[model samples]
Target: MKVVVRVKLLPSPEQAEALQATLHACNRAANAASGVAFTTGATHKFALQQHVYAALKVKFGLSAQPAVRVIGKVADAYTTRTAHLDKGLLGHKGSKRRARSEATPIRFRPDSAQPFDDRCLSWQLDARTVSIWTTRGRMKNLAFTGSPDQLKALAEHHQGESDLIVQDGMWFVSATCEVPEKPLNTEPTGFTGVDLGIVEIATTSTGQRHAGRILNRYRRRQNRLRAKLQKKNTKSTKRVLKRLRRRESRRARDVNHMISKSIVERAERTGHGIALEDLKGIRGRARQAKRNRYTLHSWSFAQLRDFLTYKARRAGVPVVVVDPAYSSQSCSECDHTSRRNRPSQAVFACTGCGVVMHADTNASRNLARRGEIVWNAGRSVSRPCPSL
Candidate 1:
């Protein structure tokens, strides 16, 4: 139910530097605290808060309690539930001991700020107006600007509006008050099978295909630029490298968002639940030829999967991941399983039934079959069967 609303901060250059410095200090303190917690068996949040408080007190003369509160918020992030354990573990590690460039702006809050405005709650818009009792006096109606959707989303969650204090260029707002509603239960009309591949990003059982040509091209260009930058070792080359890295990351994210949105829309329109390969530990299990290591490493399979998951969740559609064992090799027609079934990357032929199909299409069908099995397992005798 916790959703992150990322907004661009319009801060001056000096403010940006100050924010960056604060983030770095926070990271170092968090790391030091985590190490202490690990060795002493102290509470993680308390340990982190103590370190942050000490550091902020010494460096910036900031009050100990607020600094402690900030660190406590970071520690609280560790407790949030995630589908992927590795990501949560990585987050914990990063929170305590972040690399130089990995530091980001953040803040924590205990509760919502007050004026008790009804318009904000009614229109699902964040009360752009709020009163904060500052040290000097009461500051009134500070503008809270961000994405309209994000603001509305936040307002919908929190009945009361809170003023997010801008400290060191970061907006520290309270967490949403209301948990997101559970997805509605509706009998699925059909199922959409999704096959994820290295070449073709995704292929649907409905014969819709999304090619990864543009993504691949962008990656290749990025690699070439990286190589050139490494060889040049000049200041200009470094700047170019930074720009290229940012461009590549933005492009990749954009592509993944588009792909995920398209898939979710298709499933929603057809009133079908989406079925995908359960690619747990897939990256660890992937085998690569010596020459293909770079290609394999650059592939953003995890990112795409994450995008699909969140998008499906937001759209109130169910997405099931089926066991991927022999999805490519097993014949969807005769259920015959062998390495020979997939003679090439693009083709699949059943040995027993002589059924020929596109490799991706066959995998999609297999995924659909697995989904049906899962759906059946949950079904009760009293419930009506889906009209497939």
Candidate 2:
């Protein structure tokens, strides 16, 4: 399994200046490469390298490896964007079309793309520093640190390349490492259905609830604070607003980690496979209903599910995703699907069987049933469920 841990860097003044300069050079080279790629319709890495590589090294003061990395970054950027663009406009992004898509002009922003491989960047766990290939030369043994847990991972499981990121005027390296997954040996006890939502973070078929009310309250307070800050329009206020946004995001992420950890731990202890609703792209699918749109539009279902998945994989736990359609509206007791079954956000009353339950809990039970069907149909095969 691959996990990324961010470590804070404590570089000397000279090292910091060099760091900024190297990144600035990379930015200029990437933008130049993006321009050349768009103009000559050479979005492929080899074609881009042939067209602009030598010039980038000489002009931007970048080394051979950084120059190659810059062109590769630009090519990746265009490749990602071209997926959403019309096929006919794949190689014609530079053309003057009647109405151009957002992907038409492939431009790179300052400090947008910087990638380093083993050749350009190396980790020094013993010295608690890193060596980065720079314009001058390799910036060797630049001091850095992180939490003990993160540092332990760096010392133990460090495997892949790391990204140098500057956010909120701080330098940090996001280190990716490959770690062996935890071994779990347990027979199947049953299946636990999990319902993910905005109201509460999760509701399990076993009647467990992880509330997200605190996070919601915090977001509301921040929204009000931001609105008040925007009225001033001063430089300090803008900075404060930006810091506020980052702080709120960190809080949400921390909460998600805690909730996901608890959920996975419970499933592991109970020896049950987890069943979850397939809610990918749920934000785009939600209606623009005035009161609910803000919360729905910003739901973090994807983050929670991702956390669950990695944790489950590490523990050798089973995770199954069932179709979300009618999972909430269908009665778990009678198997009757109805729009009226869920009359309110929190209540679920089956008209046919007249079984009362929490809306999310009922949905979770339905998911559990789906998982049972999958397990029965193919006990020998691990991929029993029709994955979403």
Pick by lDDT: which candidate is best?
A: 2
The number of the candidate with the highest TM-score is 2
Angstrom error at residue 223, model 2: 0.4
TM-score of 1: 0.72
Task: Show the colliding residue pairs in model 1.
Answer: 31-96, 113-162
The segments of candidate 2 whose C-alpha lies over 4 angstroms from its true place after superposition are 86-105, 182-187, 375-388
- lDDT tens digits, residues 1-388, model 1? 4555433344445544543444454455455544444455444676656544666556543344435644554555444322223565435554654432134222223221212123321231345543333222334444445767766666666544332334423554443444464474357776788888779988988788988888888788788879978898999998777656567767878887898899888888788888888776766788989777777776777888888887777777777778888988988888899998888999998888999989999999889888877776667568678899
| List of clashing residue pairs for candidate 2 | none
| Candidate 2 positional error at 244, Å | 1.4
RMSD of each: 8.0, 4.8
- Model 2: ten consecutive residues of lowest lDDT: 96-105
Q: After superposition, how far is residue 185 of candidate 2 from its true place, in Å?
A: 7.5
Off by over 4 Å in 1: 24-40, 44-60, 73-148, 154-182, 380-388
